[model samples]
Target chain A: MSCWDTIADYGLRSLGIGERLLPRDNFTLCQQVTLIGSGMIWNVYFGTLAMVSGFFLATAVALGKAAQSPLLRKPSEWFIFVFRGSPLFIQFFFAYFLFLSLKQTHPIFEPFTAAWLGALIVLFLNTAAYSGEIFYGALQSIPKGDLEAADAYGFTGWNKFRRITWPTMLRLAWPAYTNEAIFLFHATALVFFSGFPAWQQRGDALYYASYFADKTFNPFIPYPILAGYFILLTLTVTGLFGLVNRRLNRHLPQQSRSKLRLRPNLLR
Target chain B: MLCYLTTGKHMAIYVSVLVVLVLLAITAVTALIFGFGGAMAARSRFLPLSWFGKGYIAIVRGVPDIAFFLFFVLALDIGFEMLRHGIKCPDWTAPIWQGNDFVVCPEAKLPLGNAPQWVHETYAFFLAVLTFSIVFGAFAANVLYGAMRAVPRAQLETAEAYGMTHRQTFWRVLVPQMWVYALPGLSNLWMVLIKATPLLFLLGIEDIVYWARELGGSKTPRFTDYPHGDWRMWYFLALLVFYLAFTRVSEIALDRIMRRLTHGQATLAGEAQRKAAT
Candidate 1:
């Protein structure tokens, strides 16, 4: 079949549209590309949703970690440690199995077994822990002068945090936070490979790429195409984060401001 | 039943941890070698070699490591088979990549095609190690390069004034001093390497993740004498605890080592140590 025909049939295959069965024989480049591209929609969906939601949760976690009371600080510390210390792959497996066991015990929890909820829960907690650590470090590193200035102006408690502490914490954490965001996006690839089953053979880009590789016994094509798509995806993530970083630092003098540098050292 | 947990399949789970450790050791050595070479190349006067080393670090940075992990395993397998086909069966006429089949003469097959099951497992483990080394090496190279630069120029100049050659200074002064700066980054990388061990399952190595799924999944009487419902959650929870404990221990050990290394040095950590002691 021609490339156009392949696209027409498999364009939305990942969503359970247009095709019932994947092309088992005569796997064309177009079919591989189209299906893998279709699969990318899932990756972007998981990454974007998890990163966005995780951002707010992580701020709360960081604040909790920075709290004066040991009651708040201790739990937040352990939460961050548990998630940060373990593998994301294991987290997925554990979450899936936990969800499965929960489903068995309570049929009402069945929805939690599916990838939509299962993977999201894992990614959300994972990102929150990582970003929480970054934000916690930033909170500790916030200039003491800023807090003193707020206190002198009679700002205290919520007002002090809102006007001075929170903004500065975010600003200080922005660069490292950007790195955490990109890693979270890349990590979404692992969701499918983990214990969570991709319903209806619907999976992310790596899944479809592996499928094509298995079918064609050719890795040279499909894997590279998937990598290409991921490269573009990473570029887009970097661009979006860079824009936010710029806005966060907009008030700072150019010489004093830090740029969103792509330091790969933040992996994991 | 719990009886199955004491059987050979359970043994597989324990053995998988060994596989992970073995991969860790192999990847560490190979990545260090790769990192050393890349670090040296980046410092080279030659523009092309420096650019190539720099590019290797840059490209792997943004892309998801899982992408490279998947890509390299298959690509390396194909490349190896093609090499074996060229050498082992010179008289064979069949094309290597025909339609969807990568058929080589039976003699050209990796692990010799008819080798024992253990040999095939060993081969897969070897490939996983190589892939990990290549990916992590770039990160290591980046850290090493920065550490090398961070070593004060005055020390190097003093070495030069003493009539030591650049190579001698690099080995005796620069390399020794660079570790203090590199320790934090390298320690973080070690944690990443530990977390990455689970990806071995994707490469077909029967690591902890694989066995957890296998042993945890629902078992029927047909499959085994002790049938049980899915217990993967518990197994993975056990794995989670193992990792957390391991990382915590590593963190403590690394902190101690860093403290020792920074003792009597000019860095902030050293100053803190001095104040605490007094």
Candidate 2:
């Protein structure tokens, strides 16, 4: 088959579309690329959903962590501690088993046993913890003058937080938040690798790359292709986050704008 | 019921904690060595060497490290065998890349197909250490590179004016001073390393995660004296507590060290120390 035919056959294979059985023989460069690219659909899905949902959770968590009341503070602190303290791999195992056992009790939780929901929940909690810490630090380090000015303007509680505190916290936390985001994106690859089973051979990019590597005994190709896709991913994340970063800092002078530096925190 | 906790396989879980600790200690040392080398390479006067260093640091930036953990174990294993095949089975004309298989001569198999089980275990462990070092080394290099730069230029210049050569200056002044700056990053890396120990399972080592699953999985009453429902949640809860406790202890220890490192230095941490002394 021509490369186009190959692409058409395996392009949506990760979503379990177009092709059923994977290319079992004569694995072409095109097939590996397409299959792996298709697999990226899962990675992107997991990363984006986890990140988007996690961001809101992270903001609440950060505020809770910074709250004055022990009722709010204690649970928030422990949540961050428990999640942050353990490896994402262990969390995946624990959650999968938790869901598996829970499924025995109720039919509603059956979906939670699958990678899409289960692993997404794990990644979501994991990123929320890490980002919550970052946001908490940012919240703590928000300039005293800013809060004072808000108070002077008769701003209080939700009004003060919305107009002043939240924006400033985001602006301060943006760089570190950018790092959390990229790492969270990378951490999505672990979803399939962990205890969560990739249903119907539908795995993420690393899953497909390993699939090809195992099939061909040629790691040189598939891994680099996956890395290429990942680098593209990293670049995309930086570029998009940079836009928000720009908007966050648009009120400030040009010289003082914090550039998004990709200092990677490798694993949670 | 308590006896179930001491079953042979359950004993492996206890041993695997030690395994995780050993991997932690060894990987930390090797990763430091790799980091030092990578940092040196990255800051070299030669353009190519510096580029190589920068590239090494940039690698983990883009790729998910689990991908590296998965890729390197297989790649390194096959790579070693292929090298041995070239050396040991020189007369064999068959290609290593047979369709859907890596057909190295049996003679070329690492630890040989017939080697003692310990040899195979040691070999696999060695590959895992190398992979961890390579990936974490890049992270450490990134840390060390910034640390080195953070060492004020004035300090290096003083060493140079004292007739210290570049190597002497680097060894005596630059490396010594960079540690203060590097400590925070290194400590964080240490926590990351601890969290990463469970990934040894992915490298095919029967580490703690392996034992957790084996011991926690529901077992039939026919197989053992103890029978229980799936207790993985409890096993994992125990594991989670182990990690959280470890993290807390490390944080305390690291805080003490950070205080010591910052005691008299001129950095912000040091400035805070000076203020507190007053």
Candidate 3:
């Protein structure tokens, strides 16, 4: 087959759409690139969905964590700690099993046993915990003067939070949150690797990359393609977050506006 | 094997925990070594060395580290076998890359085909440690590099004015002081390292995650006693509790160590310590 036919055959293979069986022998560079690129669709889907949903959940969690009442604060603290303390790999295994067991009891959880929903839920919770911690840290570190100023303006309760607290917390947390988003994108790679079965051979980027590697007995090519896709994904995430960060800090003077840096050490 | 330990098995569970702790300790020490080397190289006056160091540190920035773990284990294993095949089986003419199979000579096989089972397990574990060290080392290098820079230039200048050589200044003045700055990052890295230990399962090592899945899976009547139907949630919950307790203890221990490390240092932590002491 020509490279175009090869692409047509395997391009959407990761979505379990175009191809049934993977290339067995004579695995071409084109096939590797095309299939791995197709696998990136899953990565994008998982990352985008988990991140978008996790964003709102994270804000609520951060607020809960920052709340004064123990009723609210304790559960929030425990949720963040439990998720953040454990490995994402372990969390995937645990969640996958939990969903499987739940499915045995109730048919409603049957969908949750699949990688798409099961792994997404795990990724969502994981990111929420990490981002919630980041947001909480930012919330705590928001200047006392900022709150005092809001109080002076007679902004109280939810109004005080919605107007004054939330924006400043986001502005302060933007850099760290950007790092968390990138990490979450990277973490979507782990779902397929974990216990969540890639039903119908529908796996993420790492899955296809590993498939090519296994078939070709060469790790050099496919893995780099996976890394390349991730690099682009990371860059895109950073750019998007940076745009939001700029808007968050747009009111502040240029010197005071914090630049969103991609910190390498923020991996977990 | 202890009878009272548990009805199913306790030794494997305990051994898994030991493996995790060992991996953590070894990875931490070795990664610090790699990080220190990378940091010093990055800070070197030589351009090439600095670029290599910077490149090493920049690697983890864009890529997910799980990719590194997956890629490097296979790559490193092949690399070791290839080197051995070239040296030990020099007379052999068959290509190592024979179509799809990596046909290294039997003698060149890692742990050798005839080696004991423990040797194979040990070799795999060793590769995991090396991979973890290499990956985490990059993060540590970034932290250490920043810490090195954060050590005030004035301190180095003062050491120079004291007639200390460059090596003396670096070893005596810079290294000692940079720890205060590096402590926070290093502590964070330590937590990340603890969490990352479970990835060892992906490297094909039988870690706690592996055991949890294996022991928790449904067992048939043909299988011996303790037959259960998908007890994975419980096993994983146990694993979760194990990790949570481990991290909690680590947090306390690390906080205490930080207090010790910052007792008389010249940073905000130290200043606070001094104030509290008085």
Best by DockQ: 2
Clashing pairs in model 3, backbone N/Cα/C closer than 3 A: none
Per-residue lDDT over B1-278 for candidate 3, one digit per residue giving the tens place of the 0 to 100 score: 24434754557877888998999989999999999999999999999999999999998778888889989999999999999999999999988888878898899989888889999999999999999999999999999999999998888999999999999999999999998789889989998898888889989998888887777778776865655577889888888888888888999998998889989988787899899989
For model 1, residues B129-241, the per-residue Cα lDDT tens digits are 98999999999998999999999899999999999997999999999899899889889898999999888898888888888888888889897888888788899999999
TM-score of chain A of 2: 0.98
Q: For every candidate structure, what is the RMSD over all alpha carbons to the true structure, in angstroms?
A: 1.9, 1.4, 1.8
Q: What are the per-model numbers of colliding residue pairs? A: 0, 0, 0
- Tens digits of per-residue lDDT, candidate 2, A200-235, equal 898889899999888887899999999999999988
TM-score for chain B of each model, two decimals: 0.93, 0.96, 0.95
When summed lDDT is taken over every stretch of 10 residues in candidate 2 chain B, the lowest stretch is B58-67
DockQ of all candidate complexes: 0.72, 0.76, 0.74
Off by over 4 Å in 3: B1-10
Number of the predicted model whose lDDT against the real structure is largest: 2
The DockQ score of candidate 1 comes to 0.72
Displacement of the residue B210 alpha carbon in candidate 3, Å: 1.3
* Model 1 accuracy (lDDT, Cα): 0.87
TM-score of chain A of each: 0.96, 0.98, 0.96
- Candidate 2's displacement at residue B11, Å, is 1.4
Judge candidate 1 at residue A77 and give its lDDT. Answer: 95
Q: Residue A31, candidate 1: how far off, in angstroms?
A: 2.3
